[model samples]
Every structure is written in structure tokens, then in C-alpha cells.
Target: MNYEGSGHGLARFLAKARQGQGFTVGALGGSVSIGHGLKRGMRYEQSAYSELNMHRIVFDYLDKLFPAKNGRQIGGDNTKRGANRFVNGAVPAIGSDYFAMCFGHHIPEDVDLVLVDMAINDGFSEKGAESYETLLRHLLALPNRPAVINLQVFALMFQTIATGGDIHQGISSYYDVPTVSLRNLLLPIILQNSSYGISYFDHPPGTTELDREGLGTRHISAKGHGLIGRLTNAFIDMRIRDLVTGLYGAELESRLVPETPREQIRALQRFNTYEAIPAIPPKCLSAHSRSPTLIPSTNKGWFKYLIADQPGSIVSFDFVTAGGLVQLSVYRSHNAGLGTAACWVDDMKDKRVIIEARWDDLVSIGYTVTIANDLEDGDHVLTCELLEETKDPQKKHEFRIIAVIR
Candidate 1:
């Protein structure tokens, strides 16, 4: 039951579970490590074929796209089967969408258990909890969905055997699904094993000094991973079989723990920019009834801001006058579009100057047009063009500008 410090115990559990019945396994997340583990568990005679097909597909694609000689890792006669692998760098931000896409394609209805190990990167940011919740909802909605088991890591566990209950709680609630908090299950073992060199045991097959460092940590080591992979595969397969084996007997499984590329042909459409604030001059600038007067003074500067579709979103416009004077300022509520405008001085810098706007509702959005008279005389140019952000939830538009001064 406790898989943390005892790989043998974990492996034995898996082996025993395989006697229950049969089941389909699907894995997705940071990498192919977890799935490989599951494939190894299957203990099926045909696992080699399945794993080979997956390795071929993944490496072949990688080779064709990035032909670096040293990058290739998956080709050999001993290559395992049922170990398909695909990598999507959408670890943190777009994790919800990534998982959605994976399940939407793989893991058909008949699957008994689906295991996922993700969120290591998501927890690295402030918005990780929110993203995880979204992923949970998507899974719960699947009518034919299998039982879900989410695996995770904790920040502090890297060095000690401490608990990660808080992090695990966040994960469990988000998915509203079952989770195997490995932090709780494996911490003790991992801590104990920390002293031992890598690999399941000493004198491992093809043991090398490097391989002994503890079975590769980040992505799972080649040999150590293979061992864990087989154990996990066996465990999950057994669990699934037991869950559905008897028609009306005590459940064999612990708890019925059941379970598009678009083209770029239309270049015209490629240049399309979805305006955050549709190109429109600030209400103040429009009201002033003058395309911002090109101030020749080096003391004044211009700025603009991009705001998201949230209430209280405000874009601040600033201008600094000659003699270090804070001349004029404007605030535009980001209602529903790409909105921008500029200000200028007549005699400060002796030429036009522009600075992109910074939109921070809480920050003092101010810029010095003069900068202690830093503008050396010559034909100066100032320009600002609004940008349209693509409709991506993760993309944040703070500020940007276009200009040229001669």
C-alpha cells in the first residue's frame, strides 16, 4: 500500500493486482514517463509492440522536426511496447486545455483507469490552482470517463520527507476526482532512498556511476523508470481487473477505482489582429479635437496601455512637461476594446517623443517626457499604434508601441 520508500513493495502490489482481470491504461502529462510505467505494468505479452509503435511515432516526429544527432533517444531492439509518448510544453498555463485535448482524443470509453501526473510547473505560479480546477471540471463532465488518479509532487519534498497536504488538497478539490498524493505515499521511502545511490538497487544491470545517482529525477531515469514503470503498469492493470471481475461479489478492486492542426494557407487571415481595444483614440484625445499636437518641447512624452476585459480595468495616459513638470494625465476605463492615444509638448525636448503606456491599475502610471532634458536636438519621431491580442486566455497584454523618429 505504501509505495514511497519501498519500490519492491510497490512492485509486488502491482504484480498481485494483475491477477484480478484486464483493463486499458492511458497516461498523459508532463512527459511519457508515467505511461511507460503503466505499459510495463500490463505484463502483457504484446506490450513490446504497443511501446514500439509509440516510440517510433514520437521519435520520428522529433527527428524530422529537429535533426539534432544527440537528441534521438528511442530506437533499439529491446524497446518496449504500449509505451506511446507525446510531449506538449503546455505544462503550467495551458495545462487544462492540453489535458482536455489529450482525453478528447485518447482514452476511449472502455478504459478502466486513467492516470495523470502534472501540475509541477503549474504550482510554480500564482494561477496554478485556477488552471487545475478547470481541468477537474472537464474530466467530471465526460460521460464515459474512467476512474481518475492524479499524481503530484510538492515543492519541499525535494530535500525532506515532509508532507504536502496543502498542495495535495488544492489538487484534490480542483479535480473533484481521486488523487494519489505521492508526496504522502512515497516521501518516507524517497527520503530513505536519498542516501542510496540511484537505481532500484546496487549492481543494477549495466550499472554505471551516473546511473547510481538514484534513477534520474526530473523525467525519470532510463533503468529506474523502467522498473517503476513495470510496477505501476502491473498495479493499475490488477486494480482495474478486480474492480470489474465479479458480477455480484465483493469488489476485487479496492473501491471500484474504475478507471487539430489547422493550415496557414490564407496569409490574409494570418495578419489578422483581434483588437483588445479596437483601434480608437482615447476619448480625451478625440475630445481635444486635435490629433495630439506634435509638441517640439523635449520635456513632454507620450504613453498608452492595454487592458483585459475585467471590471475596473483602467488605461492611464501620461505626459511630462518641460522643467520636470508633470503636465497632463488621462485615464480610460478598458471597457471592451484596443484603445490608445498620445500627448506632446511644444518646447520641451524640441522634438516629438513617444513612450508606450503602462497599464497597471494599482501602480503610478507616469513617464517623464523630458528625462532631465536627455533629448538631443535633431528631427525626432513619436508614434503609437494599438495592438489586437489573439483570443488566448493565457496571453496577457501589458503594453507595446510602434514608432520612428528622424
Candidate 2:
């Protein structure tokens, strides 16, 4: 398999770490990195029904190459128990932008190598690019200068490959980060190999079958995830071998250093330098009898939010800043009661932007949307007016203002 971008940084890091210099590996992404279809244990345990995801496989390989002095279990359980050096910080259905809000707290400071896999969830949004760059910049600026690898895994379809692959690749190139695209390896084989007796572009007939399991549509099956892990490990192995052999010449160290584009660096700097004003606690927001109510979030990972059942109800808040980019952290849910909201920034009199807040999942997940990116740096107000009640009669509008990232 051809490693699409460059893995110079990753190669150098692995080469050094392989010789008893143990390193901590961290992963942040969507379901693929989370081992969605695999069995879950108390720790990072893999049962008979479960297989190692890419993160786990990488950890397993690392442990093999440089065993820990006091190693515990070697599966998903190890990560949970902190017995393993790997940290899986992936949240299912999350995109690049969503990661920005909780990133400071979720990603550990001591992470030596970080693998990001969010190709499918990020889709093809311009904001995805911006947030992706932001994530990369944050990682690159870490004290340890961790090697960040962008992993792009695809479903059994061309469209999924094209969209997710392009966006991740673009970011990877801009930052000189190493990237691995599973589609790049599987596409040609899928097109040419008829002997596999499988539908290379679609899920197999039964969900229980191995081929179907291997061609997991949106969420990859256990076998599919295992294959990705194997391929990724192989790619890393090859790159490490090349580096050891001095195939990259004298410029290897320089090549490994990330050379982020100047414009992107400035954008990220602006994003980072901006002062953030916390949202008013949900308890203070007034709600009508028919409006969505403020409730304690069941998911402790997210900030508290408000939910509205009545259309036309409004959730308003104000903050002072020298206005620039103002981000709204809202809880978007696909379950019935959730509906779209028309966002008005600054003076209530002036209309800035309107966003349709909806999701496909029943559980409420926190999402960050840039409400006002170009506000004149100063005091500004934001209001999310529920436009229409959700189609689900039983469910009401769900909204939350978790944090305001300027």
C-alpha cells in the first residue's frame, strides 16, 4: 500500500521509540477509532466477538516492538485502566469542528504520537478544513512535538472515498503530516480482483457474514477494522525501515518538522488568541411552558444545554468581546423533539446567521457551529430561535450553549 502523503515525522519517531524509548500514543476521531462495532469491555479488552481497531493494533504493535516494564492486559481495557500507553479519545459521529471545543481537556499533554481519523464524519465542509487545521496546529505546537498521523478510512463506496479522502489529504499536505488512506489501497484491488467473490463496493448480503462484516457500510465491522489496523501497522513498519536505512538522506529531520502554511498558521493563531466568554448558565434562561427546558446533561462529557419543545421559542445569551469569530456549542440530536434554529448574532435587531440544528442519532451530542466568524471585536449577542418543532411528535427541540469560542 502506498502511503499517500509523507510519514517522515512518524518514521523518525517510531525508529527512535522502537529502541526501548517508550512513547505514548493517542487517537482522536469518530466511530472507527472508537471500535464501534467491536465488543466493549471494562478496559480496552477484545473478546471473541471483538477485534482490535487501528488504535489498539498500533498499541499492540508498539508493545511488541518495545514491551512495557509492567504491562497489563493488551486490549481495549488497557487504555481504560491506564495500564497501556495508548489513549483512545474518539467520540462517535464527531467531526473536526466538534473536537475543537473539548480538545483542551480531552487530549493529554504527554501524548507522543497522535493519530487522527475523522475522514467520514467531517464530510466536505470548509469549516472542516479550518477546524482540521486548528486541530493539527494545536498538536504540532505541543511541547513534545508529537507526530500526528491522519488516517483516512472509507466505506465500500466511491463517494465516501472522494469526499473524506480529499479534505483529509488537503490538510495533511498543508501541514506536512503523514496520512494513510485505506481507500487508496483497496480501490484498485476492488476493481481488479474478481476472485474474492465479494461485492467490493457494497455490503454483503447478510450482516452476520464475514464479507458483510468486512465491508461495513458506514461503521466498519470487526474484520474491516482489523484489516485497517494491519495495513496501518504495515505502512508504519515500512516507513520505519526506510528511515533506518537512511533512504530519506540528510534532510530527514527537516522533512519531519511540520511546515504549516503561513496563512493557516495565522488563522489558527487568531483562533487560539481570541478570548472566550462562557455562556450564561442554563438555569438563568427563561423558558415558556411549551419551550424546551434546561436539563442536566446525562453525558458528563458535554456542557449543560437547553431543550425546547415549542417552535418560535428563543434561547438568547450575550457576551462582551472585541468581536471576531464567535462559536456556539450546541447539543444537536436526531431524536424527534430536536429541530432547526435561526441564529441571530449581535444586536437582536441585526440578523447575522441562521443554522439548522439537527442530528441523525437519538442521543444528544455536543457540536460546535461558528455563529459569527467576522464579528467586529467587541460586545455581541447571540440568540437561537427555534424555527420549527421536530418532526418527531414525541420529542421536542433540544439546544444547548455549551461554550463560546471566540
Best by lDDT: 2
| lDDT tens readout by residue for model 2, 68-177 | 55553432322433333676777656667766544544456667788888777666667677767767776765666777877777754324345545776766776777
lDDT per residue (tens digit) for residues 265-359 in model 1: 11112354442212111111111111332232222222332223332232323332222322222222122122333333334434433333433
Distance (Å) between predicted and true CA of 250, model 2?
A: 9.8
TM-score of each: 0.35, 0.69
CA deviation > 4 Å runs, candidate 2: 1-6, 19-21, 39-51, 69-84, 156-161, 189-205, 208-216, 247-323, 331-337, 342-353, 359-367, 374-396, 400-403
User: Could you tell me the C-alpha RMSD of candidate 2 in Å?
Assistant: 8.0
Which candidate achieves the best TM-score against the true structure? 2
